[model samples]
Target: MRDSAPLTPPVLPDRPRRAARPLLAAGLGRRDAYLLTLPLAALSLLPSWLGGPPDAFLRVALPALLAVLAGAFVALLLGRWPLERVLMGLLTGLWLGLLGRVAFVLLAPGSAPIDALALCGTWIPVLLAAHVWMLGRAAGRVASQLALGAFVLVLLVCGALHPAFALNTVGNVVMQILLASLVALGGQRSGLLRLRREVREQRLGADLTGLGDSLTGLPDGRAARRWLRQASPRRLEGLAVAVITIDQFHHVEATHGEAFAGCLMAHVARALEGALGDDDTLSRLGPSELAALLRVPDDRAARAACERLRLRVASRPLDGVNVTVSMGIAVYGGEGDGLTLLAGAQDALDDVRDAGGNRARLGEARRTVVEDMTPELRSA
Candidate 1:
């Protein structure tokens, strides 16, 4: 939301940095989105009868409307499509509209359809627009946009000066060639390149290995669940997520140094990792919290993994001391996304957190297996 003119149109990606209110990036290049609303811009004609048309606006508004939508359609859907090529699409589409509007006046109407000046108004707007786009910062990428625009304007001027000297055929053909060239060049630079990077960053963010905590090297529940949501349960066999917490963390900290408690957590993380398969992600969610996203082959296999991890943690020594950890497991894969899985695991964790914290509770497995792992199970 730049303080653009009213209804200037939307273009570009949303501002990724802004959390509360995202703004659309600068530029509106999609065409189908534009053509869809072409009829609406025509209604701008109504204001003409009241206040009179602005200096050559009504003539250009419809063209600009069509151009913007055409540009966006090319960019968003047709990856590898160039903004320059999209600009060409806009140029050709708007120019075609101009030809239609002009032809409508010349060969059809008994009264004057469009005066020569009004006809020139059509090309002028398109040319002026091309010139502006060429001057924008993106212009630095393709030096030829400015040149192409200049060439098209020159040809348009040649046609405007003498109809006998210029035929629409020659101008139309030249415009098409320039547009195609622009598309090949611009589409690669701005369109496809920008799109691929966004996808790559998103994939890496969900990567299981990338997001684990540095100190504990365990994963928080949010990252674990998101990773499981993306992973294939069928391929990995039995995949489950779990939340684990030490009981009465305050008492434990008071009994031992906080440094010793940290050592205990580190020991617990190391033990879980050693106990589970390599395809697991673990993190610390809070002071007393730990989460795990694990993939095994089947339900029985998942249960075995859970049991092995529990036994290992229980049997392990931390600073030559033993501290029990309660665990809650939630199976993930195609079951649901985000909170549906996480909340189930959290509910189970809360149950273990409450019922003395030395054992593992099954949420997704029981929810799927026993069919009676009710939300009330935790309270019970």
Candidate 2:
């Protein structure tokens, strides 16, 4: 019995956490797919050589247009599908290079090898643009811009280095430089628009996901008091407000740690939801505290209603964990004013603390009292 237990590692509890799939699954509809149209738009620069015969025109027109569309599609696909994207780059470059060779030879004889290189050069920039557009706002913007710039410099250097093809080389270099700059600028502008859209979506999601805490979502004491006046207790007879908090919740937190406290609060919130009506409005009133606005029309009925609510809560355990709730109830006495109800209700709720844990007390709503920003409340 005294054989000292082999020093054992402590067991750590796993907290229930949300899955990342939600964030990833948060996607754009057809409205968001408009970015993909960029590459297709680039196809507008088909072989429009009015000087050439119909046969010559068709020969240039078909290949060039196909090259543009295919280049963009492959690039866009590659960005989304990494392995496929690499494959697309290689295959696209090969086809474009071959096409460029043909286009160059037809337009300018073999004497201009530099012109041949320039046609081939268009492939890289087009693909880069498509990849950047496909990458959305994240990694692609920088990548696509850098690729365009690098490709331009390569063309310029190739031109400057090969003096034999000076006329062809210089003309191609200047034109390509401008084109690259435009592509780079276009990609960046699209990136900026995409970034803004992403930010807006993230902000809207945060609002929907119940991500905000009580402090931000709940109005301050003064704000709550003022809002209650709109409740119009006279028009509707009995609107009861209950303010409840877990006394010594901090003490439990000190002993069990914040994780346990959070678990407890979550459990309690669930318990509260189960005990109340579907229409009841609830908010975090203070640290480890909650407030409920119960709409019941009369005095005795309101008191009975409050009692039933209290009993439902007191009887149910917090997720099978040993914990208790202290409930404080205040009824709106046809006084629709905010401060009167809030202060009176909060004060009455406080009185139950002296009577020991697991008790509910009722009173008249106070007039024009400020609200407390508790950590527990979140948006509905």
Candidate 3:
């Protein structure tokens, strides 16, 4: 049996976690898509003047109008307009883009009628796809079917006018339908997945919020007690608990109302946590009461820690209202369990309360009363 025993390595825990998805998705919202529109628009307009126009007026006016609409899109997006309002701006840009091409064709002196009509075959479908994408769900499907029907009618007109061009136009229209359908399908799936993820995260956050104080986000009494039981004797060789209660808490709560009192506690909790060391654990024991467990070398170190935390709380303001805290500190390793030590700290707090708070007291025993000591003696 002794020979059979062999050495084994200890199992280590996994590393810190990362987000499930760090990369941005292929489908972009209004915010991300708007950023790329200006550059794309610029490129599209760069060659507008290459071919001479039928009239100089059309050449000058069309690009300028499109530029103005681009600026409007940027303004609407930055101003945080509602979704429906922003959609209006986007649709306006597309409509202006279509009109710009029409003006260019009309102003050209040698342009044929079929050449002018070809612009519809090219630009109208694009506008319809944008409409489909923006509308989404039932509205999008209706828009898609309507667009398909309109394209078929346009194809019939082109066949009667120019049979040779109509064959190629049919292929182009078919390709547009397939491409738009694929993009819409992908975007819809990505949006649904994003919604599911957001719902799940909200539920998890709500559960975690329930396990802690709503205002301070500090672990409540139940979690605090469980942590103490696990750490007091096993993890921390020397443990000292300091119970800090806000001075005149009941009166403050009455004067300011519950909402204001909760806000004040949250500010105080942040200050207290910032002043603490890595080895110290802070929790909200109750309304207006905070509990801190300090891992220190001796009783002197614990009191010093308590004084630092008390001063930090006293110096801070709760929304322009000055506040102070009284601490009752009890050290372990002298005698008793974690709960007994917590009781001793509470008993010492009673003495501090009796002496008109804004001070601290040391716990010698469960029923023992220690004389008042100044901040100097308490720290030493």
Which candidate would rank higher by TM-score, 2 or 3? Answer: 3
Best by TM-score: 3
On residues 1-380, what C-alpha lDDT tens digit does candidate 1 reach at each position? 00001111236887668455322344344444443444454453354334444334436645565556545554645566654565555555554544444433333324233333243334433443343343343453344455455556655665566454234553444445456646645554565456645543443334643445656745455566566566554533455667778766778788887887787778887787676655565677877778776766544444456656776777776766776777776665555654566677788777776666676666743555434334333222
TM-scores vs. true structure, each candidate: 0.40, 0.39, 0.48
* Residues 194-279, model 3: lDDT tens digits: 77556533532222223567577676777667655655465545788888899888888899898888888888889988888766
Off by more than 4 A, model 2: 1-226, 229-237, 307-320, 364-380
Q: What's the lDDT of the predicted structure labeled candidate 2?
A: 0.53
lDDT-best of 2 and 3: 3
TM-score ranking from best candidate downward: 3, 1, 2
Tell me the deviation in Å of residue 31 in model 3: 18
Error of 2 at 160 (Å): 23
Candidate lDDT (C-alpha), each: 0.55, 0.53, 0.63
**Which candidate leads the pack in lDDT?**
3
Q: How many pairs collide in each candidate, listed in order?
A: 24, 20, 2
